[model samples]
Every structure is written in C-alpha cells, then in structure tokens.
Target: MNKAVFPLLLLSFSSLFPAHGSGNETAALHRRYASAATEMHRVQVAMDAINAKLICRGCKIDVVDEIFSTDFRLKDQNSLGYDGKYSEAVYFDPPKDLNQTNAAPERALSYRGWYLAVKFDKNGELIDYYLTNIHK
Candidate 1:
C-alpha cells in the first residue's frame, strides 16, 4: 500500500470509530443524576413553585392556591422514557388526560415560550435551573 494511501485510510478509520470516552462520560453523568433523584425532584418542585407564582400574579390567585391547581405534562414527553438519553434540559407540555372535574385554570396554562434547563456539577448536585425561551 502507498504510504499516502495508508495514512488516509487510517484517518478515515479513526473518524469512523471515535473514542469511547464520551460514552463513558455520558453514562457516568447519567448514574450521577439517577442516584440523586430525590434531590433532583426537590429542585423540580421548587422550580414548579416559582412558575406557579408567576402565573398567579397575572391571574389574581393566591400563590399557594395556584400551586396545587397546576399540572404539568412533558412537552417532549415522547423524547423521554426507557430509551431516553440524559440531557440537561427538558420541556413540559400542557396537562392532558384529566378528569376535568379537578382541573383548574392554572393547570391549563401554556408553557409555550419556556423550557426548563438544568445544570449539574460533576457530583450531580443541582446547580440551578433556567426557564428561558427556546433558542430557535
């Protein structure tokens, strides 16, 4: 084989089969997130509380009252589940499959312009969550 051709082939092979380090890193991060589920849930609840407060202000409802009235369904729910990959951000769709009898105005609010993005440290501690519009 020509020297030039050999180097080209080697380069192509390298690109086709990149290192496994990134996969391992992703798995480690996922494990971190999994083990810290309780803490993550707390962070999620706190964020939901903040969203409830924001909605209540414009709707003339008590903040505490609004919280229990709110319901969340993942806007990207299909992108999550058993095959879901770990991600730092996720969005919630409007609530559905309700009995209607217990539904409240706040429960039907749209999260159209917002997304929930979370940051975690190497230890998987909750750093913070950002509620911002999608970057188009």
Candidate 2:
C-alpha cells in the first residue's frame, strides 16, 4: 500500500508541472506583439499627417500654416464647450493672416472674438479643428 501511494503522489506532482513552450516559440510571440505595436504606431502617424495637411471645411483655409505660423495667436490653449469638449482657439490678431489666403473666405468679424479652434492628440497630431466666435 505504501508503494502504491508513493507512485500516486509522484504522478500527481509530475502532472502539476506542465510543459512550457520552447524558447523559440516564446520569442516568436514576443516578436508578433512588437510588430503589431509598430504597425499601429505607423498607422496613427499616417492618419495624423493626412489631417495636418487638410484644408478647412468652412473656407478651404490652410490649417497647417495657421497652426505652424510664427505669427499665430490664440486667446487660450483650450476652450470648453457645452458638449464637454475642449477646443483650442486661434485668435486672429491685427495683420490678419486669413486675408493672405484666397481659398479661405475673409471674415469681417475677425476681431469680434472670432477664432479657429484646433485639437491635437498626445502625439501632437491634429485631431479636430473648427471656427468659433467666443467673446473674450
């Protein structure tokens, strides 16, 4: 009976330790995850680049220039809306840059608390942008 119990205990202990994957298999899994992460990052960058080059829907304005221009002015870094969304306001100060573009229609209310709001992602990629008239 003691011999029989010893064999049973040995079998139970052996079953407790399951076989692990080979080193190559583990490395392969890691490589797959790394590749997937890299692909996702590349896709995000491409989408952001496309958006950065887009023209404004309201007036075909060059949004890239407006955001990147040295003369760019802003009332605030972010504006909160009724919908709980935050927007960045681009203040159109004197010597307005909008007049230099033919595509984007010039506005008479450039100084009456008018601005272009832009939102960017953590990677500094343009996500959403729009025009807003907020009385400063």
Among these predictions, the greatest TM-score belongs to 2
Model 1, clash count? 3
Task: Report the C-alpha lDDT of model 1 over 1-136, residue by residue, as the tens digit.
Answer: 6988999989988654313233343344334434444544434443544443322212211221222222222225454335342234444433243446655654453344334554333322333446566655
As a TM-score, model 1 comes out at 0.24
How many residue pairs of model 2 clash at the backbone? 0
Q: Please give the range of 10 consecutive residues that has the lowest summed lDDT in model 2.
A: 55-64
| The best candidate in terms of lDDT | 2
Q: Which ten-residue region of model 1 has the weakest summed lDDT? A: 56-65
lDDT for 43 (candidate 1): 41
